[model samples]
Target: MFSEKDFIAGQFNTIETASFEWSAPSNIALVKYWGKKENQIPANPSISFTLNNCKTITKLEVAKKSDVSSFSFDLLFEGKPKEDFKPKIQKFFERIEKYCPFLKEYHFKIDTQNTFPHSSGIASSASGMAALAMNIMSLEKALNPAMTEEYFFAKASFLARLGSGSACRSIKGQVVVWGKHAEIDNSSDLFGVEFSDIHPSFKNFQDTILLVDKGEKQVSSTVGHDLMHNHPYSERRFAQAHENLSQMKGVLSKGNVDEFIKIVESEALTLHAMMMTSMPYFILMKPNTLEIINRLWKFRTETHIPVCFTLDAGANVHVLYPENVKEKVLQFIQDELVDYCQKGHYICDQIGDGAKQLN
Candidate 1:
């Protein structure tokens, strides 16, 4: 929960329609967070780089109602009505209404669109929920103008986490740390914080997405996270993630590309490995996924380009490399790995500035 410093008593404006818009970027975790507890708390801490091009923009228009006891909202995606999203949005509002009593006093019109496809292994939920949380906090700020800008983001992260755990990390820029860690102070299970003390070389990191599969997943991330509850290796995976985060923190700060590549790739494979070993196993990686990994390994070994691969919960790959070696890496990607991708397509994005409010 946020402290008094986060927000003061609200004074709602009489304006019939108050509009807000915010854009938030998706992130790829370097230290993977695969499992969680109830209330969206991660089993282990994770760190990620906020992406540049892949994002979600959301516009919310609020019309105050005479009664303050009922919540009403309509949602649209890419300007088309998305009736399926209403239940999730309703649950989100219900979860956050305790912290924000004014929620029930308004009828909301939300227009959200993603720069990328849904369920494309890009973590669209992270950016989407973060942007929605940002828009809500924007209105909260209007009601209580005394809140600090830092607290504004903190509150947004807090709210977003209630919707999606990874969404909390999307609220911060460059790099972000979610879940509490002993090495970092002020970290919380409730919100993510910007992990800023890194060497300049790391700030310009690159992630080229290899779209191996564009179709919907056989198992949703929600199901994957749920599977971890009864997973035989769940405890060991949690401890392993903690240990990996400790090692990678030093590697990230020192800009050790070699160690960074190893740790990140390991974490990615370990994440999928956990899924495969679950009670009722499921394989998220395709045969092409393995082919791309082999190609990446061969190319890196022959050329010494320091290229590496990481997978989300889907079949696609996120090729991680330093900015200096981007040209060589991209050339290799085109000549060799792109054939494995769906439609030979990919998205080039880097660590980016965090969520921004347009209005």
Candidate 2:
């Protein structure tokens, strides 16, 4: 129930040229959240694995100016000014400006860089927004030393959620669950909670990204989310997600990779199914997408290697497996999946230690 009126700002005022950097990982959703309510609220609860290597690092350089005013900032990407990203940042600031009282007194120069390229089926928004949230949290901490650690992360994830719903989960740990779920304690639609009760085996999982199509999706994630409003199976999809989420806790805790593979792949296909059945009826998966899937199934069967594939909204496939079988999976990727990827490019990543400050 916190509001703008609750914040008490205006302390020490002579601060100048404070900079903070944070790198946050993109997440792969096991139970995909396709739709949303107002305020970026998810239609159903979703769980995801926070990835390493595939990340966005954002540096915020701030200098104090006015005591209390609206947001004024310069935005850049990879040391270059990104005019395309400004409007989105502006809108995001507008939504959460009231909460960040420190934002009013400082001018932010945000420079962002991503490890993976754009429109490459990686959740850049999640990582970028999460990094930005951590940067702002850094600023707030510098301004007010009294802020508690629990509130610090809660507010950080809360602010990130205003930018991107998935970004909320990115601010947490190895695995996170976003949205209100009956199975989890203290779960809320406001911010994500880290999946703490996981088995040690699940912690070392690897995600090998097989890039089927590097190009942008025909239907943007925003449009796809909007289309869920009129989608015939929206209700059922949400229900299925809830059921899957309840089951996922068990799968994760018991280290059930088999059930994990089943639920994860089913969720991936179901996400695409919703997209195909949308009013516009478009498909994001390329021919190579299916080819890679078939190859993964065949390879898993023949070698008895525990490898499974789950897809995002785009055409790329994320080949997920335990770290113990990394050698076999990488060999399979090079031998079978590489040809299907655009220009034979793929990325190898793993479950990360969550976002961190880069000093």
Specify the highest-TM-score model's number. Answer: 1
Could you tell me the TM-score of candidate 1? 0.96
Cα miss at 265, model 2 (Å)? 0.4
**Model 2 error, position 164 (Å):** 0.8
Q: Between which residue pairs do clashes occur in model 2? A: none
Candidate 1 shows a clash count of 0
lDDT of 1 by residue, 1-359 (tens): 45533443355554566899999999998898988898788988999988989999999999988887678988999999999989989999998887777888889999999998775666688899999999999888787777788888998998899899999999977989998888866778889988887887787889999999998899988899999998999999888888888887888788788999899999999999999999788999999999999999998898888889988889999998889999989999999989999989899999898899887
Segments of candidate 2 deviating more than 4 angstroms: 1-14, 67-70
Model 1 ranges with Cα > 4 A deviation: 1-15, 119-121
Per-residue lDDT of candidate 2, residues 1-359 (tens digit): 33324443446445677999999999999999999999899999999999989999999999878656567889989999999999999888888866775566788899999999876767699999999999988888887778887777777888898999899888878889888999897777888888888987787899999888887778889999999999999999999999999999999999898899999999999999999999998899999999999989999899888889999889989999999999988988888789999999899999986789999
How much lDDT does candidate 2 score? 0.88
